[model samples]
Target chain A: MTIASITGIGWVTPMSMGCGRDYKTLTAEAGKLPKLTSRMIFGERLPRFGRLDGYSKLGFAATGFALKDAHLDQWVEKRPIGVIASTVYGCLATDIDYYETVVPEGGAFASPNLFAYTLPNVFLGEVAIHFGLTGAAFVINEPELSGIAGLRMALNNLILEECSIMLAGFCDAGRPESFQYPVEVTPGAVFFVLEKTPGDETLSYGDLDMDIEGTIFFKGAQVQNLQNLMQRCIAVQSI
Target chain B: MEIRRAEIKKVCIVDTAVVTALGNTLQDTWKRLIKGDSGIGPIKRFPVGTYDSRIAATVDDLRPIQDRSIIYDLIGRLLAGLKDIPQDTALITATTKLGIDNLENIRRKKAARAGDVLPSSMPEMVSGKLGLKKAGINVSASCASSTIAIAQGSAMIASGQADAVLVCCADIVTEFTFSGFSSLKIVSPVPCRPFDKERSGLTLGDGAAALFLMSDERAIQEGRKCMATIKGWGIANDAFHITSPAQDGSGLASAIEMALVRGGLQHEHISAISAHGTGTMYNDLMELTAFNKVFCGRKLPVYSVKGATGHTVGASGGIEVALATETLAAQTVPPTAGFQNPEEGAEGMISSKPVYLKGDYLLTTNSGFGGINAAILLERGTNL
Candidate 1:
């Protein structure tokens, strides 16, 4: 079996936003707190952000950063390269919006755009279509550990030769005013690219730094988001 | 697909259970499907006559208990006789929308439990009810969710990482999905007529099914009833559209061809095909195109249970696979319910009466809103 190596990283946090390898500049410029915007993160690469919900926006921006870090930004590999993402409350914002469109009196004011993103897996579709990934992609719903579980599934697929490269992570935004969850959350997304180890095809990718766990094996990785990368890797798939 | 040789493993489904609109159990559901019974009717959750559509294939008992609880009940009934779960058993769940009914209640200021709105709660409920601590996956591949779940579960077992896997899928007819499809103008007022020239759109439904899968060796050692063997599976994305299939059916054909290649079989060996057949103009047409292209008009006899069971969304794939496996075991092909006439591409390939065949293989396919396609190949129980 092939051991998956985390080669590229990208994250969105309350205080930082960039590729995973830019630890020094991110730390030095840590004072620039909370600098993750659609324009700043995605530039002019992605589709118009006006139509997308917040969850898709957060995930799309992080995916763009990961693709950049993996040097697959403008290329489409003939081989299979997929995505797997887990979310705590996947698109709850849009779910609320879509639901408010209907009434009990046989009147519905639903928006087709909002209805499209209601499914949690739509995030994977957005990243797949945007990045031109046409392989086996999956969406997992769990706690923060969903990210690690997503990574394990990605590795399993890679080992089985189902896909050559994978982008696995978690993205979640706080619930709207009406809906109440057992736990509170912040708007965040963290994604990483995983590939089989010892590959000369991806030397352009900086280094194989992080493991299956969310731990950053690199130095000067004391950022808050780095310290707590989507909760912890709880080894949920080791059945 | 470029076919490649693979070291195949022997994974077989030991037992199965279902809670469909047609019936509560697999046997009852099979009888209704074989007889071409229509489980579709007018919507009762709310007034539907005001909209362009008014019919759906809803479960007889969708009220009083939450829709998410149906999976729990089904799993409990399925595992009632089991005393213990194998330590190596894993869980893989699939559903496109989990607890959307509860979310709708909250939006309408109706009484709703907080846990119903949580997606993780479904798997957590399954694990907790089954008395397990390890985490499991909840797949959300739109309509292909459960198909991918079963495929991935089989993959895990075949790869020697898991001894058994519990695969479950469920989806309920909700105002969210009903109105969403209605807003898209794809919900039929009457029963959906899949593959028929006059077919208008799909009919949403509520249901769930569970399958306990294990390797053939394990099943024989434990003396479990191996219903069918999971021969092969495949997944692909069209990258074409967000809510529709590729115009030429290339993505679906790729998935079907890959499943056949992986199963080490040819089109001549396949006895029947279970299509996605959502009754939408594009979906049925695209599936027919793929079938004609892959089978080359061999009269393989394609059928879609959606007309009888309603489009169960996430649960349709798993239920269809289970029914197809049962058909293989019994040596019969269920009729394509509500199919009055075959469309242009599917001429002579669909029938309204149960067709008996003496082949070992069945090809099942499903496509979702995100241009994702999944196909699975199964062998008869006797072959295993």
Candidate 2:
């Protein structure tokens, strides 16, 4: 069995923005997300933070909080800390934003800034650059942004010793405006910093157990979803 | 503490299939590749009057099925040639933009499947068609999507997560992508000349590929002929820029070094390299810089299929993997089509003629828009 310690958790949602342990219950109404500034998250200027698309902005803010919660934000050198993020409607809004530029002016007025952020993985690169992380980084597109898939894959990488640490989560900045069906998608992000289970569990939230087949378990039960797992970790820590 | 070490399993490529501008099957692609034919041509699928670079290696004959997304048609043609894949095999689909045309239709208020807009939809459709138990995850790491997918599948098998995996990827040339690249100003005005002195930029292409991988014991039990060995793989981000690679090529160098260490092979053991030579000035120079850094200026043979097939975006890596198996079997690296004059740094490494492989292992590398670089090492297959 491969075991990992959940050292930190962070999320940025319409309801709240803070560490997972400090997160409040889901009672706040969903609406427009607050303007996330680098000063609010990092207390310093993040290079290229202003040019990021909304999707990358949401993901970058959440990852920054997670690193801060883990106290790994002050690193002076590069580390092999990988990142694996999952999403459902990845960069669709940005895709639309970029596409709209192509229609009016016969593509002569296409925006390279918007074009750069079209792929979901661009934010991964952004976060890597911000944190000086040099490990295996990629994005997963799941049917639903529950983040279990990415979490499992992160555990596998840890088991295989592919990286020293991993930041695993999901971020969905839902289509700002849908073209059809008026579909509503919740815009939020949740990230957890994971590392090999340490001998000292003093700062760990909980232990994540996984078999070689990639089935993950926590507290002797199979992990159902990201929300449930976060709740369980918070509950155990509060005790 | 009863800590159990993860047992490493031997992963092998049993079967492969591809549909590119050059041909519809691996055999056809290999035949044309060795003969040094270019499949890239002027674009005709959509209106290109407004675009600066109007040519691409498009599969011109493939019409959308049922007036749906062209990606479905591309996938159908690529999968129709594959056979006998295990029902339990996990599926991982890769694409920079899956069914992106559907988004165009939805925007223009035309009929289209809304589900197809999501990258996950590809695996959902493929799993339902093939009755796969698991609706696999989709890797959307820009152009490195399929390469990372292959790496993930190999990791799954190496860690005993799945007995078999089928990695299928597809991408089509569309106005959206054409316009995006045009905006980036990296589209070559002519057919791309990878690693060439006069290389302008990349020529976009339409392509798809399906590679089935299995454990050595499972392949032996199923009596499947192994085509190549999945020796090692690594993925890394440049952390330098989103769209541009580091000038020093340290990111790709790290990935290649990681792959070498994982595979337990030295740089000299690699017979040749299948480079992600997209023909862009910065990209070609970056690849040469990385090769020089990793191989210590040994003058290793390097080649690119994009010169013939154009840059297939996410599908390029998968297509190249299919080509790598053939390269390993035939012990030859195909000519870098469109390559007439080699770049200064790539003088002895790239050529317009095919080169015979001198070793069993081949290194295939790809760098994408998000500064994502991936490298996979493949060993010539041997009987179990």
Candidate 3:
């Protein structure tokens, strides 16, 4: 089977902003876990582990860079074939705001602005709506593995006669309360424009030698190994 | 690699974990289900003002695990004996609403910025919790998320990609979900009735279910007890509407047909069907139409366990598959609760009582938003 390669990689993490820089640069700048930005506003009630902003801003930032990385900015006017955006946590902010008003305050209506973010796939929807790429648009919620799964799903869709170019990735603007924890919480988005044509671009990312393997019962050790493998793969590619 | 027979070698309900209003474990859930117990109750987790529909099948007292963590702890007490852990396993989680339960609360307060909710990222939290070495997460299509996860995991094994795949599907009941469905007017004040004439709407529930998939050859080689084999699966899109299903049921019927073809069986070969009867008027009607289209009036005992366990969003598909597996293993299908009479429109479509049968094949089907539909065939161990 002809495997799909990452022709372009665009990312927005806490360490840095865009895919213009490689993973190494981002990892190198990985400093101590930042304080929950919400804490500054909400005090003790804020979460300990979350990203800096939210997913939309981060998603757009990443998309812009990834389009440039893939040299598809020129095709932005024409719009691509498909879009698959996966997020473990959808637009939670919108849901929270909408619920607080309607449920507690006895508000008769929900804010249409807030409601716009209600759909978890709205970020991708916005990208499609903006780009006018209407081939196939899907939103998947696979938790942390959403990124890899999004890539694989895009690959499969391309193979199964779904679309030609697939914009696949995962994005999340961390949880509010969880941001206070000791862990590294960052709002990030990563996207790749997968195409069948293997275009001629000097900086083109290689195809992923991917294999979806493992048993249903995974322990801590197995998860760590998978993380290590991913880290190593990114590191090797960087080198 | 010429794709020959797409045989799903071995599928293990390796680890089943659930958090519902009934209980947390499979045993507890089964006990509650057998006694016709209701997980729905007054809304306590969040303040429900004057909402007429205050009932829900909620998982009470679920704390936040660290970001990117394993979900085994949700059913930690039940898994005391299984010790042989695979070191290099991949993790795949399915969920509809991830980590938005509490974040929604904070967002309401406007206490935190929007960016702070990233840690609640469901897949990252689950992967981090499990600490999976190689992982692939899939939200897939709507209610069929987890089932599709299982199917994808099985495909991974069949393709010799991974030795094992841990597929977990989880969702939590939140005010956001309640409100969204309520806006759609699909929430029933009372319990849900699948295929019943008086069926009003579906009551939403939250829970997580996990399973393991490995090759039969590998399992036998390792002397592992082979629970069952995933015979085949089929996935398709309706291309009709975003929320409502196509009335013609062409997409669903096509999926069923493809599943049978993939499993190398005829419609008569299936002993029972675990249906996606969401208790909604349109969903039940469409599913019945699809069933009749496929079976052509063959009375294959059909069961919808949503009555016992409210519609569990993404986890519904996986949980139903687990229930179907148990039913097949026990050779006794549980009766669909609240199924008094078939709907006027679906008269000859649904089965009223649980019929005892001696067959090796079970078919499970799930449909989700975005016109996504999936079907899987599970044959008895003897067939393997």
Candidate 4:
């Protein structure tokens, strides 16, 4: 089956921001923490220890870059695109703040504005809503692999299930201290635009190979036997 | 493209590890399980006020290695003996609440930490720990998460995506999962009694299990011992309620039927079944109905280990499969610990005694909250 190629890539991570032109530059200078882009929208002194920049702003910036990378901004109205956005932590900072405001204060809250961001997939949903995408919009929760799995599933749909285009990736913007064990926090997102097409034969992310049947050997004398077999295969391949 | 029942050749459980209520190390947990002991105890980690469910299978002080970095240490332990894990081998992680236990702790201390509970971010931490530049983490479909992880890993290998793949599924008990199940009023106050008529509900437990998969040709070349072959598997969605399974077991039965069809077996070929018996009213009943539908009223030995190892959630499928492999290898089926009386409707189908049976085939099934149902067939040796 001819699977889709990741023609467009957009990313925002603690180490880098934007995609394509800016992304290459940012990633080249990696290992630095991303700025608190959400603080500007919500204002400084946001109570949360780990808060990303405003989700909408970050998402819009990433999308603009992705569309440019895919060269699909103009075709957005005509193309049936499947949008899948995933995250381990959604807009948790916004949720916690809204909850506190409503429960402790008991008044009309401006927090409803943040409710849409709480659903981890809202970034993708927002993009879909903005583009009027009538195709499938899926939100998966697979912690870190969400992006890769999303991309794979999208490829499956494009090739096997017959979808035209898929916008898939992972995104998260939260502080490190917000976790049980605090590590330096970085805000990051990566998006890919995939479409079903013949293999480029020249350029690709990497070849995808899958095996549905395999052995799972545990503790036993057979372990040595299995080890020998592995060694022999590699040896023969090398020859 | 034709779907061939892919042949499993070089299977290597490149890594195997566990974190159970008994102890941190796989050796400790295995010792406890082999001795026929229980890890259920009072909830000490968190205060479980007058809620009926107080006892649980809690992990001992993992506090020492609570940092996300511990996952790497655990992986290192699991892969200690393996020699042929290629640098390019895909890493697939399955967990219900990835990194959320830490997030929950932060949330309790400061509500602002809630934003850290997303799933997309967990793989990076794990991959970083494993020194894996290429990996994937899946947290979809609840209890079947790890099972799906295994399935996906196998698929990756079959598709030639990688020479070998590492599949790890882990989850730690947290206030969020405990309280969430508590809110559903489905947690038993005592140890779980899967398939029992008087069974109240499941006892939530936490643990992690990892499995390594490789092609049969590779295994033969490496001389790695092949333990068991994944014959076939079926995955389907109920599209039903988020929590409650479809009462008729339509989705569950379809998955089982597909699994059997894929395994090239009739209902009678199954030697035994490792059920998902969560000990909850709805889940147990739904499973019973589904089993009956698959077996067509035939009597087959069935057992659930939840009584011994509480409901491990996403890890349950892999853990149970591991136990089932042992059972098949040893040709000894352990008695369902808490099977006192079968439910009124499932009396004819439930098995209570630990009957000694020898058969090459075993069927393992798991169900999750989002109406996700998965079934996999395994055979003792490849010839089956």
Candidate 5:
């Protein structure tokens, strides 16, 4: 089993954006997410923010908020912080968009900018470059436990001492317009800052635990997905 | 509650299987590799009149199983070679694009398996085939997918989290991928020339590889022969560019240093290296620069198989690991196909002729589009 302290939480949904958001309010809202702007990213102006695809924008915003909430916004040198994220229909929407340009011009019009974001891991790279995180970063896709799996991998990296801190979460976008598959999902992102030990002065959401079998628990209760863990964090914080 | 760290355990590669454009089995591929054969040819899978690159390495006479994705056929062929897999073994698949051709079909208003379009479907398909009760996860880092997956699985076993782990990865050269690389202006019109001064770019390929890793105690209990032992593994990111590598090669150098540190081994302990060597100007240059820094300007033996198999994307690392085991067993490093003249940084490192191994340890490294870099150090198995 492995244990880590959830020092910070950041999420972006249709209803709310930023760290320490109310889970109930987010669950209550049922509408399309507003267009994310650079101003929403903790007052830091990102010149490339407008150029990012929707999926990258959502993930980048959540991670930016996560680091800021954890009081790690400034970097004197490159930090050994890692990021692992889970997705189901990762970059498929961008892929279709990129391919559309290829079909018309017989590959001559294929957008290089769009092709760069075809893989799901590209967003993780954006986060890493912006934060100067030189630790291990990758993306995982799981049908079930989509969010929890990323957390598990992050905790494993922490336990192995691969890095002292890790940012784990899930990021997904709605199905592409031309995609024939029917995948039920909301376009959003959620991230948690996990540290090997709880530091002084920083508020910890709770102790997160995972068994050898990869089963996860938060506050002694089994959690299936990131939403469940978020609700648990909100419930515990309220008390 | 008590805080406990996982006990460090020894992890061994009990078995490996591979199916690539060169051959359908690891033995066949190894035989062709040592003979210095090239599998890259004209791209007949799709029309390339409008594309910059017209050739790629493809599995000959391959048809999609049940009109689904070629991935199924590749995985089936790969899984057929394995005899016994532990029931409790967890699975971790690696692929940048899982059955992406299915999406192309769907877009063209043709019949397709919609579920296969999702990356998660890969693990589902593998779990069903393996009859594994535990769920699986799919890693989707670009070119470095399988390398990271292998390292992750080894860490799981070494940390006592899993006794056995099945790491499988596959990626096919589809029009979607071909066009993407072409648009990026990195696909070589002719076959790739790794480490050559005239090296142009990478050539995509179709392949799949599986590595079954088990803890030393479990492998002994199962009476499985150890093919190789994972001594150390490390992963790092350049954090420089999304698609470009750092010119200084600092990120890759850091990863290599970490691997040596974690293995409790010194730089001199490594005998040779299996480089990523995509043949792209930046990738090959960045790798050579990193090698120079890590080995401290020593002319260590380095070889790449991309010229023979083309760039297999996600399967490149797993396939290279299989070849690494063969290198240890045969005590020889195969020649780099399509290589003649060496680039400036590759003068003393890379060779077009086979080099005999002098030590038991070999280091394999891969870097990808996300600035992701991973290295794994393998020691010769006792039986070998």
Candidate 6:
């Protein structure tokens, strides 16, 4: 009997940001990808997010907002928070850049940094290192249903009492169109802070479905638009 | 009012099968393992060029099938006898890189064309092929992927979420796979020597293993044989380094302690141990330290099959567990094939020859790249 309550929501897509301090909601034309630079990721930064890849930068920044929204500043470095992240196309861009470095001279040079992100598990490692999360971490790649899978893994761990609070989210980034590769994936990340209810003092949003006998439990997690939150953040009521 | 489980359920391992470099059936694989045979040799499909490693353990019998048909074929063999999966069974697929070999093909085409890249959601595909209707998901966490997936499967049954669960694990050894480890300098030029003083590093292997799990009641009702029982499981992170493990082995020890607590068993009850034993310096040292801490001066017999299977990556855990279940049933432990001289703090623990099972319980563990570690406790089944 596992009951996962949504305590905090932190979503960052091309359209808007939810559960952040300066929440930004765009108009109806906000579904396109945002041009993200290092400056836009960490403001007033001389060299904040330089070492991080674009794929990891989006995930890392979105997770930061989720963690901060959960008020886990004191607990971030101390407690072991389990993280289950979902991705459709993971590390595609980074793999391209890494392989390009390897093929030119037939093993003449190998960049260890580029080699790090070649595998998808490295993305989970980067996020775990950034947040000091030592709990069980799984980076699942399920075509269209990765977000739902991530939620189930997180809920299973939390219900088993491994961790009271867990961070489950979806992080997807587009690959270079010129490159010939796999399936299609849009660029975005949506993170939710799931807390085991009745133990912690945080207010709950609602209960998440855990009985998996029939329908998909995480089916209610998606939203077509950030219309409600957009109205509060932006001056435009047409959202 | 709160939601609570009525009672803790016993997770039972009903059946298991494997396809490795040696044989296709589980019995055949176990027989060859007991005789201490290694299938590692030079790969003929490609060239090594100037790489650090020259050979790998590969399953040569598997012909190239369709895109996802390899998994489908292996899983079909796993579900051979079972008539009813009850439409509520959980299907889990574990792999490090499902179809990473395709990346090279895309590159050869000038990187300007589209591709039939590996589907990230392979579990759904597997479930569809098997005609399973309830739930499906994929788990990818480096080498520990299948162990974690197996543990999750057992927990789903133990927690009353599902009546049955099937875990399928497979990974192919490719040039792209070889180059990465070669770049890291972790691939041994010769066959791997796990826990030996002269051990250099690991050799990669390609294989697939599947474990069908259900509750004890379901196993009894269906008149199925209970090969083993999943008593406990644990998962933890070192948080020390991205690739390297902690020197003190605290992270792994914590997980061992948790599994013991969960299974309601002590270290003294453990008869045999199936170790990760990746043949690397740090991995071997860290595992020895953790074993010493958990066993507390008890030199339990330890063995690793990597000498024969050659670290199948994500598939390694499932293969190891299948072998462990065989050991539990046979009441004998196979020799650590590549072990000759043992490392310090691991003296007398490495069984260089066939040894009898000491007790009724066995512990299997795996550690992976992201500082991730996982373990599952299996109890010998008497009802089989």
The lDDT per prediction is 0.74, 0.86, 0.61, 0.58, 0.86, 0.73
Off by over 4 Å in 4: A1-85, A88-148, A153-239, B1-15, B22-35, B66-84, B108-122, B348-353, B382-384
Q: What is candidate 3's CA lDDT for residue A75?
A: 45
Task: Tell me how candidate 3 scores on lDDT.
Answer: 0.61
Query: On DockQ, who's better, 1 or 3?
Result: 1
lDDT of each residue in B129-186, candidate 2, tens digit only? 7888889889998988999999888888887888899999998899899999988999
lDDT of 4 by residue, A53-76 (tens): 355345544654565556665543
Candidate 3 chain B weakest ten by summed lDDT: B68-77
Error of 2 at A7 (Å): 0.6
DockQ of all predictions against the true structure, Cα-based: 0.37, 0.65, 0.14, 0.09, 0.65, 0.42
Per-residue lDDT of model 5, residues B246-340, tens digit only: 98998899888888987889999999999999999999999998998889888988999999988999889999998899998899999999899
Which runs of model 6 end up more than 4 angstroms from their true locations?
A21-49, A75-77, A105-111, A175-183, A197-203, A207-209, A212-239, B1-6, B66-87, B110-116, B119-121
Q: CA shift at B191, candidate 2, in angstroms?
A: 0.7
TM-score, every prediction: 0.89, 0.97, 0.71, 0.66, 0.97, 0.89
TM-score of chain B of each: 0.93, 0.98, 0.89, 0.88, 0.97, 0.93
Where does candidate 6 chain B have its weakest 10-residue lDDT segment? Answer: B110-119
Estimate, for each residue in B1-384, the C-alpha lDDT of model 1 and write its tens digit.
111234335789887878788888888899999988988987787656557888888775555455333334444554453445665567887887767777766666677676666667767767777766565768888999999899888877666556688887888887778888888888888789999999999999887888888987788888887788888888877777778888788778878887887677888888889899988999998898888788886778788999999999998888998898888988888998889888887887788899887888999999997778899999888534
**Model 6 lDDT tens row, B1-384:** 122445667889888878777677788888888888887888764467767788988776554354433334444554563345556678887887665555655666522113324435467656766788744767878889899889888877776777789988888776666777777788899888899988999989887888899988888888888899999888877777667888888767877777888798999999989999989988899999998999997989888988888889998889999889999999999888788899877888887788977678999999988788888899998684
Clashing pairs in 5: none
Better of 1 and 4 by lDDT: 1
TM-score of the A-chain for all models: 0.76, 0.91, 0.70, 0.65, 0.93, 0.78
Recovered native contacts, candidate 1: 0.50
Better of 2 and 6 by TM-score: 2
Expressed as tens digits, the lDDT of each residue in B308-361 for candidate 3 is 778888788877776666777778766777678987655643555556768989
Per-residue lDDT, model 1, residue B8, is 39
Decide which is better by DockQ, 5 or 6: 5
